[model samples]
Target: MTRHYLRNASIDQPLNVLVATPAGGTGQGGIDRIMAALKAELERRPNGVIARFAPTRGKGALALSLFHLTHFCARIAAWRLQRRLDLVHINLSSRGSTYRKIVIAACARMMRVPYVIHLHGSEFRSFWSNSSPIVDRSIHALFEKASRIIVLGTPWQAFIAERVPNAHGRIVIVPNAVEEPRVAHVGGGASVHILFLGRISDRKGVPHLVKALARMKDVPGWRATLAGDGAVDDLKSEITALGLADRVTVPGWLGPEETARLLATGDILTLPSHAENLPMSIIEAMASGLGVVATPVGAVEDIVKDGKTGLLVPPGDDSALADALSRLVQDGELRQRLGAAAQAFQRRHLSIGPYADRICAVWQDAAAAHRGEASLPALVTPTDLKA
Candidate 1:
């Protein structure tokens, strides 16, 4: 029952794409990775394609008001440009303001330009819960109307398929790919250096990770590093409350090189999020050759193969998380085996080249379809897209 998009040779030409993303860039999460990958693909074009990086402002708005305004401006700018632009690729979070999605999608339709909707994280679930019956119907209408729907993993594909069966054929899964770091085989010891990198938010389960580590205080020679910025005071207070001031290290946010260096010193990377969809941090950790310990959320199960590449526990179970960490901390052979396996997985399947190629095919197919040409067979599958 898996459908694919067939690329039409006639319409398969270099595209001028408008990539819309949140302002801060790739450091945010998977959306950032998608933007980065799309840019990389656009660079490979011989005639050179126009890929404008449009940033949305305002973080706490209900519907991302600033993003919608920015998107509108980008649309106007794209229209004014005399060059031929084939598609508007939108990296949309389900949690983004309804106004933003509606405005952007409507603009694409008005312009008669094919638009690709890239769904990230829990936005789908959020939208499903937030909308009224009428609004929900309209939202599903939008999902069905998109030229193509890009999802992160199998779970999301299923979510969309269950709601919009016909549109399942139009859905394409393209998981985030991590760049392999040059430094390899870094960090592992009795100290069992563990790094938790990401925004310091409740959703990220930072406090949960801290609580888990607090319980393990009796386990000597173990230290946890909290890198990245978010609710600084809250995280610091939690660290103090847990009496893990000494056991836990919060170095705040680090630049790419510095983050890589910090990751290079870790034996294990842990992220016990309540919800997630193919976290870039886990992929980066795997690329860094660190044993990963994460919850079974999003495409995490697809990457951390429980006792194989890494370990996965129930999302909110601190004890299970701690147990998993303890196993890797005590067993060097197991850690090496998992780390090596993870590295191999990344090398074999998660390379950026194949990922970019698949996305390029999606964009080309959408563009071709908009031009009244036959669609391309789906170049990727739900399973293929999983991290």
Candidate 2:
């Protein structure tokens, strides 16, 4: 099928682009929400950086891989006919994400389309280092070939610069944007509600949180809600064993509305994760006017100033975590103070509109660079449009 193009037409239209990522689900994780928000924003913007979404992963591993391959092949098939695509925006993380995207990057290269890789996973550094030698080399090669590699925070940017030195010049920092609240949250009960949102797993420091709550058992008038799924049985068992079952409730996963309600109830939002890359829970907590008690891992310190916007403790230090939580639990005035600061910070800096605008700029820049490398004609599109 020979699709028509705007050949020699007015240079008003920006280059066509496609975003390839794992999508299509009801609030699966951070990446899904981010992509959905960006897609909505891109559509709203009038001129420059039009986009198409190609979902790569779905359910099962085998099915997901096959779907991704077919999607890439379809794009290549279209390229043969129209050459309409100017950039291949690839969203990635680590492990299988890197593996699949490396292949997709190859396909994009074969199609002569420039590609950009957006890193999302919290444990990406470990993923890169722990992978087999062959996989590591392939990962580096993919990073090197990308026109731009966007990471969530300065921590990741530094990680890539030191770890993937070949991608030093091309790495960019764009933090994750979240639109959510805590669900399964009941409030107005005159109890300090400390909320922990995210996966209930070892990596997320669920055990450490249970221990912290156990430490706070003697502290008066405070309850904790642990939301999200992953190792729920172990988390519940740990809570029971530590005699925190009365004060702590583990609500496996929550919908957006429930999450929002729960976030609204929070006096303090806490996540003592051992590793992270700007976790969406903290951003949402900040947005919801809740004081945050988190470890200074990933970009937690980037947005959260100690004792200003939020409180930070060392990861895996249950005692420090307890002490931090205890401080917030005891001082209602301080909680309100920090929560106000957090909300202000989020509204001013971490809102989705600004995030989308920044991403729009990145897409535009990547497309422009592709034009430069290919010596293609420049698009005379007007700037100043907010994405």
Candidate 3:
């Protein structure tokens, strides 16, 4: 689809950008939530920036391959037709993500548009460390040419600096943010609803969470709900094997409204993930005022305060995971205190407005460097964009 509203090369023009992400809100994972939220936030006020969202990937291998071909044509059309095109913000993950964005980056470079890579992968270092030399070079080349690399946390900032030492200076840390709910989760309900929302795989520690809860059958007024797709039959088998069918509810997968309702009703959210890079489940749980009980992995350690805003356990430790949830289950006051603190932490620090502000500045810097401009007009402050 070719779209051209008004072509303006004048000094006064919005910083136009093309944001390339996956087909979000389409039964995808954390990165999709982050993309949907950030895109909406930027598009909300859009002070002087006209942003265009172009989805790149879909379900399955063939769809993903086709999406690349389809989006490439759309990107070319936008570049050819739009006069105020400034930058391309590419949201990327590990493995296939880097592999795919390499093509997008090359396309951006061909059109002489500055492109930025926003890393959302939880295991990029693992992917980078284990890849063949040829693949590593391709990854390096992609990051090396990018105008900047946006990381989720300082840990990622440092990791990427070491990963692509050549472009270390281009790394920018922008933690994930979610819109706060109007009404927070009512904690300390009659029954403690422990929620685990994510892909039901061993990597996400679904069995571990079920194992933990299976042992806690004696914990009064404590029930658990497992939401999300992937290995659902396997997870159901495991839950059945543990005799937790009565204690746990595996809902398979949830849409946005169902997910929101679950989060809003959940008192304690647990993610004993084997690994993560600031998963949006934890972020959204924090926003909804749920007392978070998660493993200290990735940016989770940075966002969740141990014993304060939320409790953090060592990854892959079922005993610790169970004990953390037990603590919340036993003490209703503790749940309220922690949930309130978690909500406050999210609003005070990780709101979407500041995240959008950082992206706006990054877009401006990328465009200015490419076009030899002095600076952006600084038209929209974070305060003005605050929700």
Prediction 1 global C-alpha lDDT? 0.73
Better of 2 and 3 by lDDT: 3
Off by over 4 Å in 2: 1-11, 60-62, 180-188, 373-387
- What is the alpha-carbon lDDT for the whole of candidate 2? 0.76
| Per-residue C-alpha lDDT of model 3 across residues 139-222, encoded as one tens digit per residue | 888898998778887678788788778877677777888876645566436788999999988889887788788778777788
Query: Candidate order by lDDT, highest to lowest?
Result: 3, 2, 1
Candidate 2: tens digits of C-alpha lDDT, residues 167-252: 78677677777643435334436888889999888888888888888888889989989999888888888888888889889989
Where does candidate 1 stray beyond 4 Å? 1-13, 24-30, 44-49, 58-83, 182-185, 188-190, 383-387
In candidate 3, stretches whose alpha carbon ends up further than 4 angstroms from where it belongs are 1-11, 24-27, 59-61, 77-82, 182-184, 373-387
By lDDT, the best candidate is: 3
Better of 1 and 2 by lDDT: 2
Regarding TM-score, does 2 or 3 come out ahead? 3
lDDT for position 313 in model 3: 88
The 10-residue segment with the lowest total lDDT in model 2 = 1-10
TM-score of 1: 0.88
Error (Å) of candidate 1 at residue 206 is 2.3
